[model samples]
Target chain A: MSNTRMIELIGVQKSFGTLQVLKDISLTVDKGAVVALIGPSGSGKSTLLRSINLLTVPNSGYIRVGDHAMDFSSTQTLPRDRDLAAFRARTGMVFQGFNLFPHMTVEQNVMEGPVTVLGTPKAEARELALALLAKVGLADKAGMRPDSLSGGQKQRVAIARALAMKPDVMLFDEATSALDPELVGEVLAVIRSLAAEGMTMLLVTHEMAFARDVADRVVFMRDGCVVEEGDARQVIEQPSHPATQAFLSHFHNGLA
Target chain B: MQYQWDFGFLLQYKALIGVGVLYTIGFTIATAVSGLVVGCLVALLRLSHLRAATWVVTAFIEVFRCTPVLVQLVWCYYALPMLTGLELTPATAAFLTLTLYGASFYGEIIRGGIISVDLGQWDAGRALGMRRSQLMRRVVLPQALRRMVPPLVNQTVLQLKNTSLLSVLAVPDLLYQGQLITSASYRPLETYTMIAVIYFAILFPLTRLAHRLEARPGH
Candidate 1:
């Protein structure tokens, strides 16, 4: 990889009423690199992931993806809903809860964005949806509803739905956290395959082993800020920040 | 005792009673359709994030739902004329009253249905780049409507029976038609019994239809 930045955030801030969530955070994600964001619950890991897609626009920030710049502080707004929608289409999000449409089949859920948002032909979208479902190892269950599927299967379908959008960047917000321990492996395996395919992925995960094994760089976050970041092995073996040391020790002692 | 269970009276007034039956059907259909439209809009308003809009819808629903349908009919038929200073036909007043009554109850039903849909559906739609309108159309409404169907059918049937209250407004619906025949022929028991049977004839098929719909796969 040439280390060209696919996503950049500078001076990002977000607050919900009186409480500040993300405070002047900045990060850069290189093209074809898997950046894992690991932190305790409520540490703004998910908030940062959402900010990248403008799902939760930062209170003040300059966010650039590829060539497009979305500055929340700018007085002038994006022209129309269409402009914001187009930007969103380029950045797909996989939610922590597998938010599959229960009324729709796995194939239909995957096909929805391609057909409705992208305006692809129904037949073409269906073919692509089936292919995506197969990629996620749910080809046999394409016709089943989300209510029938296990949590892992539902998350895989959610991933397929996002992949069907053909996004330039995929953001996973603790995507495997909702799954059972045994089921998490299959979902992580699919994600690992995507990483091998050179997909630019931003994953916020609590699965330390998967992060250690799959992430090119693991960023340890605490108190709504990045405490440390480096190669997965080095970060796991050697930590410079006191916060990182405390966090790792807690987990290692089976107290987390 | 000789006047008891007079099939001859029923047979004699069949034409008049038939017209009454038609009025009941027409009123039921009109009110139910209008109520569904008003109810859905009101439900959307009530569920809106804005406090003012939700309050307005909440007050409207509360006022209508808490009051009696007969009183509402009287108010629409009599009170509205004095307030608005506009003359309305009995049919118009009765229709408006029935619509509003059904709207309030159906609004509650719709709100419940929308709330019952999993929050995950909304998240899925948002993550898929679906705007609010698309999310409502493609995900929320479909699922919500599925959940609303059984209660909606029950409401429709209730509105059908409630059309009897329109007789007081002189809309010449089934009950009024029954009253017309009964007074002229001096057959109260016979006329009202026939009226009851006619109401059953209309509601029975509707109940069956609702049952079949509820038994379907998605619902």
Candidate 2:
């Protein structure tokens, strides 16, 4: 991974009514880097990740992804829909739920972003979709509807759909969390291959082992604040903060 | 003295019955098509971010839905011309009333179907950088349309049934021609019974089609 900063967040904060979800969060990710965000349920990892694409607009903060940037605190009005869409096109996201368009076939699901957003020609988008499906190991299932696929297969198609846009970065919000235990491995394997190919990614995950194995950095958050962050192996294996250690203990006990 | 049933008198009125049936079918098709178009527009307005448009559309839908179709027909034919200062033929008034009435229900059904689509689908579309219109056309509507079919078909059947009220406006629909036949032959029993039978023929197939659509797997 290069040292050039790809994503930077400065004092990003978000609140919903009386509750503050993200508290002045600041972090940086380099090009080709994979960062795993590990935390408790209400730690705001997903919200933080979502804010990158302006999916959940932050109450106040500045987020810059490559050339596109948003300073939420500077403007009285929110960013224009056009600007938001342009910024979002830079990154791809995979939800816990596969969220495939049920009415579309697997190939159509993958081709949708390219054909609709990028305005790619249908024949070209079809080729790209086929290649993506093959990459995700679902080439034969192109014509099948999402309902007919297993959870693992659906998640892979979701991955392919996101990849069709040729995004600069990817966000995985507990992508494998909804899958059965056996199915989780296959989804993770696809993610692992992406990491090896040097795709920049930020993942909010409960998978501690995978975090240490695949992520270049691991950020531990709790109560809407970053508790500790460092090298993936160091943060996961030997956490310095009491909250981080306490959080890791639960996973250790569960695994045992 | 037992009364004798004269079944053969209706044969002479077949031309009148044919014209009535044609008018009934024509009104149903015209109103249904126009109503669906208006309904889609209403649903889109309701779903839009504009508060005033939403309020106006909501009021329009409620006004049409709360009042009876017969009252709407009478009002459109007799009352609307006075209010708007435009003369309307009986057929025109009947068409206008039925279209607006059907649109109210169609709009609600369409809105419900759209909102019923999972929120995650919206998220997925937004994440891919699709505009709201693009998302609706590419992702949301295709899925929503499947769930909307049975209800829409059901509403269309109701639309056809509503056309029966058109006879009060002298629009020459089946029931209106039946009245003519009754007055001419002095045989209300056979004429009205035949009218009901014709209505049954038209509506039965539509209802059955709706049921079949509803029963289809994976809906």
TM-score of chain A of 1: 0.94
User: Which is the leading candidate under DockQ?
Assistant: 2
Instruction: Give the fraction of true interface contacts kept by model 1.
Output: 0.52
Docking quality band of candidate 2, CAPRI definitions: medium
Question: How does chain B score by TM in each prediction?
Answer: 0.95, 0.95
Looking at model 2 chain A, report the run of 10 residues with the lowest lDDT sum: A247-256
lDDT score, candidate 1, position A170: 89
Q: lDDT: which candidate is best?
A: 2
lDDT digits (tens) for residues B1-219 of candidate 1: 554566685777778888888899999999999999999999989888779999988999999999999999998878998999988899998889899899999999999999998886776677777777887899899989887999999999999999998889888889999889978988788778878988898899999988887896755
Best by TM-score: 2
Where does candidate 1 clash, by residue pair? none
Give candidate 2 regions above 4 Å deviation: A1-3, A254-256, B1-3, B217-219
What interface RMSD does each of the candidate structures achieve? 1.6, 0.8
